[model samples]
Target: MRTPASQRALLVKISENVCYTELVYQRVNKKLSVDWSHSETEAWVQAILRDPDSLVEQRGKNYYVANQRRKSQLTVNSHNYRLITVNRLSK
Candidate 1:
């Protein structure tokens, strides 16, 4: 298991390298119900990943980042840092 400091560093690195495809952009917008541009969406996701309150964990081949303040969770490919999807958390 990684130490908290290492895990946080890893999350920061992943956040810096995160990428999004057109399909993912569309899907995120639909799921999150916000029509942000590609760059805007990317920034939003990165912010979540970098947030100290967010929880980052690896499951299988993906990194799952969840933030309660944002009320959402995001999944990214571990290998390529490609954004897979994001979903709003239900209260």
Candidate 2:
């Protein structure tokens, strides 16, 4: 099992190369209650991945990046690094 630090490092390293499909983009924004454009939403997700306090976990084929401060979790494909979606954590 990869440690949290290693998972975080690997995820951040691939952040710049990740892909965001239009379908997932719309899905993410709807789930997260955000109206950001494609670029803005991608940047927001990347920021969460790079945040020092964020926790990363791998389950099945997906990487879950969760940030307490942001109150959201971002899901990305482990193999292709394609952003799957994001969800806001309930307060």
Candidate 1 lDDT over residue span 1-91, tens digit each: 6677987998988988998899999999999888999989988997898889888889999988889999999999999999999989884
Local distance difference test scores for all models? 0.90, 0.82
**Model 1 regions lying over 4 Å from their true place:** none
User: What TM-score, to 2 decimals, does candidate 2 have?
Assistant: 0.87
Model 1: which ten-residue window has the lowest total lDDT?
A: 1-10
lDDT of 2 at 20: 87
Give me the overall lDDT of model 2.
0.82
lDDT of 2 by residue, 1-91 (tens): 6787787777676576688899998998788777889889878877887788888788899888888899998888989988888888875
